[model samples]
Target: MFNSAVATLNAPPVSIVLNWKSSYDGANGALIDMSQAVPGYSAHPDILAALAKGASDPALARYGPVEGDPEFRSAYADHVSQLYNAKIDRNEVQITSGCNQAFVATVLALAGHGDRILMMRPCYFNHESTLGMLGVGIDYVDCDDDGGLLPNCASIDAAIGPQTRAIALVSPNNPAGSIYPAPLLADILALCQKRGIWLILDETYRDFMPLDMDVPHHLFAQDDWQSSLIQLYSFSKSYCLPGHRLGAIIAGHDVVAQLAKVIDNIQICAPRVAQHALTPMLTSMSSWRQENRERIAARATVFRTAMDDLPGWDLLSSGAYFGYVRHPFTGVGSRQLAETMARKAGVLVIPGAFFGAGQDGALRFAFANAGRDVIVKLADRLSSLTL
Candidate 1:
């Protein structure tokens, strides 16, 4: 027998979508995979060398601190402080196997069965499934395409119920890629404080924002910001090291102490080699990170231009690594259309239905997985879709 909560859920969306590839015979063209938000390029040579060096060190094979390597934590703290223009103590940071685990640990620490968490619709599927498995009820604030998929402050305030423990948000959101404005985030934090709930903000795609944009937010600068705010970030995307699976949690020291218990049981510590490898690179590779940021931004421009004036498809919202698009087929479900595109058109993407209910009319394009040339071919491939 399996746990009904998890057993009842659908298979992982990426794997499900990828299975349709078996039907493709390279008839259209080389398969342009836009299903997962993997970096289109290779990891920097220095990062790879560091990873190799760390792997060769026998000391790193053993377990390290449950929270994370002390040196890595301190380096990451300094990195965060510099970016946010605030002081973040190393003690307040907790490293996890990946951002997904960081989210899981935060949920485990903050909520339990019968408690509810408010999330925005078109939410990250992993977050939703994590709550479902833990028996935590989830309430969603539906975001409209017209609003660029940003949740309304009034709606968020209204959605907070007596049992709501925290509000989970993803900036440069997973499916929609809409960046939440700094002012709007502050208002939401104020709402969270007034309602006596936690604000779990996930900034996984923060490094890929438009180059002209300033800091993502000033929440970290506010007095006692740690008491109400817990921020999550991923090193995998920025470093192009998803295989290493490293991530972090920035919160009050006390919160980090509490999450340590969950981390101890889930993963004794994050990948030791990864921690040691990335610790120095956090500061040393700033220029490389900035260069990749520009690369991703340019890809976004190309993808946006490629989607323009497409007969029936509408690019509802796009930025960072993804584009949420509305397909023109009136009655066709997003999953069916995505599958068809993968098989006949040689393009792979995720169906919006995988994100949440009422998203069946749209699909999520992880444009960062393809280069400019491949992205440019999208229009032709999509235009070829008759169904």
Candidate 2:
């Protein structure tokens, strides 16, 4: 027999296969894959060389510091300090296998069985399942579709209850791509502080935000920022290293110390080879990374322009790597539509319903993985369909 919590998210699978199994006759079009949230590009040549060198050197095969390699940790801490203008030390950062593992550690650290964590509806499916499998009830704040999927502050304020232990949110959100404004974030933090709950802010797409946008928060500069905030990020998107399984957790030293225990049990430590390889890139390839950011931003623009006024299609929210669009089929379930799309339209995308407690009308497109040339085809693929 399966666990009850497992049954909750057993609700449905992403099913790129189930979709293609039926209609993949090699007829309509070659598959346009956009299912997974991974970098479609290659890793840095220097890092690839480093990985090769590490493979041959006999040095990187052993266990590493559970918190992380000191060199990589110090390098990343310095990187964080430079970006946020906050004086963070290596002691405040913990490397994990990936951002997913980082989220697991933070959730395990903050809440447990029968406890609850508030998240916005139409969330990252992984976040939803993580809580479901852990027996942590997910409390969802309904996102404002007309208002660009941003959570209404009052809803978050209203969602908190005695059983709520924390609030976790992905900014430049996975399905919606809505970036929380500074004032809105401050209010959320204040709300969390007043309610005595932790705030797990996932900034995985921070590197992809527009160059002109401000950093996500001022809390990094606060004296007690560590006490109330747990920040998560991925080196994968920024450095094209998801396969290397490297991510970092930024929290107060005490929280970092506790989560280190969970992380130690999780993956021993993050991939040290990748961590070390990224240190130099963080310092040396600023221009390349910024250029990559611009490239992804351009991809988002392509999706926006492509779907601008298609009948019954609505681009409700877009930013970072994702764009949430309302599908024209008003009565079709999103899960069914997602499958129909993958099979019929030759495009793979995540259903919005995968995101949260209530998401019936939208589908999420992570358009950044496609290059400009490939992105050009999306308009046609979308236009060709009559869902």
Candidate 3:
């Protein structure tokens, strides 16, 4: 009566965390939620105005092209090309319902039931779950070390087997928030090119990178980079429009065409109203997005400072939107500690085990959504934990 594969999946991570948050209602203190990575800010007023206008436009009520709204495709491509200083065209980009959908479509197009995808350990759990349900082999290459969450070229090279079809990675990584250095990305890209395997780079948090960091990586500038690189992006974080569910993929024109078939069967096209609303803001709202980036950076700084003085906990990595910390408890698993924090301290965070194996002692805090005062209060609550 139901899909057995779906039954094997765990409950969604964010929802579980949200449930924990709900347990603290009317408690002694404010509940500080650091579970899900979502923008704390609202969409720009101008973007909101555009969305209202788009909603009222009767033309958008009809079905849109399966690929995307032509206006959105063109606008997004131009925006990406200008940001990366690369040669990108509308034909090379495909808009999807969200980054998750973009990833799903790419996986379906690139790998079959038994084929493998190399994922960095401490992966975004949704990616792992998606591959599991598809019966695609997930070969995890551990990125955790004294050096942090950056990919090791040697480890990544050794993980590739004949069945491996691609290497998937997320930067300003979801659980740890470690931004891979550009040189390391170059090395990984070269290795993929040599092996004739695809590099699926999920740059969902690219817009939140430090203002001084300028560009995320130089892979886009390489000759024929599209042959080895498939980049995924989300407008949700940058534009504060997660509810709109807009995301995209940038690849070779040929690959985009292949994605069209998978996407057509999935959602036909991304939401039309948001696509129409976002097309103009891609260029017009650049400065507003930059301000949001700075705001998140400030939050990251506050979290780092709060963790620095903690007696037992260790801040393993902090950037973009997350802070991965090793909990003080020696015997307790991460899930238990997370629950304890929620029920006892009114602070909610995701257990590290949700991200990958061998991570039972750590927890990931999505600190971007919490402001400085909330973060300070969170630190006080965490400090009060006896274990």
| Best candidate according to lDDT | 1
Best TM-score among the predictions, by candidate number: 1
283-375 in candidate 3: lDDT tens per residue? 999899889899999999989988987878899988999999998898899988898788888888999999989889899999998888888
Report the lDDT tens digits of candidate 2 across residue range 1-387: 878777655544555434455575545567777766777788779878877777665567788899998988899899999888889899999999989899999999888888999988788888888887888888888887777788877889899989999999898788788998877888888888888998999999998887687576677886688778999999889888778888999998899888988987777778867876777778898888888888888888887887774666899998999888888888888878877777777878887777765687888888887877776677777776766
The segments of candidate 1 whose C-alpha lies over 4 angstroms from its true place after superposition are: none
lDDT of each: 0.93, 0.82, 0.90
- Candidate 2 matches the true fold with a TM-score of 0.95
Please give the ranking of all candidate structures by TM-score, highest first, separated by commas: 1, 3, 2
Model 3 clash pairs?
A: none
- Each model's TM-score, in the order given? 0.99, 0.95, 0.98
lDDT of 1 by residue, 1-387 (tens): 999998999999899998998988898889999998899999999889999998999999999999999999999999999998999999999999999999999999999999999999999999999999999999999999779999999999989999999999999899999999999999999988888999999999999998998599999988878779999999989999999999999999899989999999998899999999888999989999999899999999999998895787899999899999999999999999999999889999999999999999999999999989899999999987876
Give stretches of model 3 more than 4 Å off: 25-28
